[model samples]
Target: MRLASLSLRYKILDFLYKVYPEAVEELTIIHVFYEYHTVDDIKKHLNYLVDKGYIEQKEICLRLGTKKTTNIYKITSKGIDLMQGIIQDKAIPIPEDE
Candidate 1:
């Protein structure tokens, strides 16, 4: 899938993986995108991540008297291994000043 080729998906997956232990509140993703995009963009990107199996979906109740609807992503082990390789392969070593 071309979706697998996009770097943005990787970024989103990395973010989710890093935050998986936390609650991953909805607003957290919005804050992550504040500099360049809107919350809608993040939501769309998250949907793509869901389709790619890098993230999971779950309904969450954000408030009382409202139907619970949210995508809670849990990073898969395969995703962790993939991200680790990507990070390692792309890392650039910094030189120390003598």
Candidate 2:
């Protein structure tokens, strides 16, 4: 089932949090949400998190015959704080399970 945008963003954050210091490629994130969301949907949420400083984004460029770019995402301290309820945002509706 498709989740609301807010819920999707929350899920993205939670998933990233589970990996902590390890950064995940955009493709991996797409796989996680593919059943419920589109690539564009996942990218939009990822960009939003980067803009809000909740996550850090890195782009790696690879060259073989053509240039290819991959986006890697990792949760920031602010993101961890948000997950821990140390900070709150009206945009992300985090659950109170922690």
Best by TM-score: 2
For residue 49, model 2's alpha carbon misses the true position, in angstroms, by: 0.5
lDDT of 2 at 18: 99
Model 1: colliding residue pairs: none
Residues 1-98, candidate 1: write the lDDT tens digits: 34333545666666776776554655666677656666676777777666655566676876788986664566666556556664222221111230
Q: lDDT tens string, model 2, 1-98? A: 33498999899999999999899999999999989888898999999999999999998875667679889999999999999899999889887675
Q: What is each predicted model's overall lDDT from 0 to 1?
A: 0.59, 0.91
User: Where is model 1 more than 4 Å wrong at Cα?
Assistant: 1-5, 64-69, 86-98
